[model samples]
Target: MGLDDDIAILATAPVFELFERDALRLLSFAGERRHLDEGELLFSRGEPSDGGYVVMAGTLALIPRRPGEEPVKVSRSGLIGRNALFRQVERPADARATEPSEVMRVTPSVMSRVLREFPDVAAAIHGGMAEELLDLVRGLSGVQERLTRLSPRKR
Candidate 1:
């Protein structure tokens, strides 16, 4: 795909929607394209995460190492590993291509450069992270409330 096409795809994602057209263009330019055959491993759990992948075509299965958990399937135009944009942590799960797949790999260095150059992009990313944290907190509060109700209290 051309630069404009990549930018258009990036813009479709909520996280990238905050960025300007020029920023998206820069991201598309910096990103590396990857192709995977069916059943190929994209990344394994415990591997150091240096970047995130944007699934441009086909499906990727996120397989949990823990027993009893079902693998989560992500399809075209989906964004994975958003945390990799800032965090230097090990991958939490295995990602495999469920079919012939195409992805755009955005490295942390590229993201850092963009963030450094564009204050608006950085602010938008921070705001998005804050919103996500708030949602997580709200979910945890609900779970705590339910647990409290289920448990008997002593006078």
Candidate 2:
């Protein structure tokens, strides 16, 4: 695919949508592309993840190590290992291509450059993350309030 195509695909991902065309162009230019055959392992659980993959084509499955954890299906334009784009971490699950797939790997170093070059994108990400955390806290507080009400009074 062309650079424009890569940028279009990247733009579909939530975080990348905050980026400008020039930022996307930089990412497409620097990001590494990989092809996966059907049932190929993209990454294994416990492996050190240094980057994220944007699914350019086909479907991939994220199989969790924990028995009860659900597997997630990622299709075109889906971004996996999103957190790893910013920081290196151990993979919590195995990612395998369910079908022939193409992915663009965006390393933390590349991501850093994008953020440094695009302050608006970085600030938007920071604000979005803070909002997510606050929402989680608020939800937990509501759960706590409900639990307190349900509990029997001290005898």
Candidate 3:
């Protein structure tokens, strides 16, 4: 996609709107466009991760499978890859193209550049991080509550 297309995509994404035009330009420098077929694995569990993705078209799926547990289909995205950005080390889930898809790969180097040059963009990403962390905490708390209910209680 051209710069105008990139701008349009950025305009729709909540976090991208925070980046300055100049910072967005810096992003274009290192970004790469990719296309994937239906059922293609964008990245598998435990693979070395480099960065995140922004979807230009079609759908992508997040499938998580922990050992000895059933796989879970997380959700599908039409505009961005959220899990790829905040990965701690390797991916805990698998991402795949649910249909013919087009996405832009934003490398760590470019992400670092954006954080350094555009405080607003960094702040937006941090906001996203906070929300995600909250969701994680809520999910964990629910799990703990369930476990407590299941365990034998003291008199």
lDDT of 1 at 57: 83
Runs of candidate 1 with Cα error greater than 4 angstroms are none
Candidate 2: misplaced stretches above 4 Å?
68-70
TM-score of each: 0.91, 0.94, 0.68
By the lDDT metric, which is better: model 1 or model 3?
1
Clashes of each: 0, 0, 0
* lDDT string, candidate 1, 60-144, tens digits: 9999998889999988768889888766779999999999999998888988988888889999889988999999999999999
Candidate 3 Cα outliers beyond 4 Å, as residue runs:
66-88, 131-155
Global lDDT of model 2: 0.93
Clash pairs detected, candidate 1: none
Ranking by lDDT: 2, 1, 3
Residues 1-155, candidate 3: write the lDDT tens digits: 68877766765654566677877777666678889999998888777776777777777776657566654432222434455454435776787887788777777667777788888788887897799899999999999999999999899
Q: What local lDDT score does residue 107 receive in model 1, on the 0 to 100 scale?
A: 86
- Per-model root-mean-square deviation over C-alphas: 1.6, 1.3, 4.0
TM-score for candidate 1, residues paired by index = 0.91
Q: How far is candidate 2 from the true structure (C-alpha RMSD, Å)?
A: 1.3
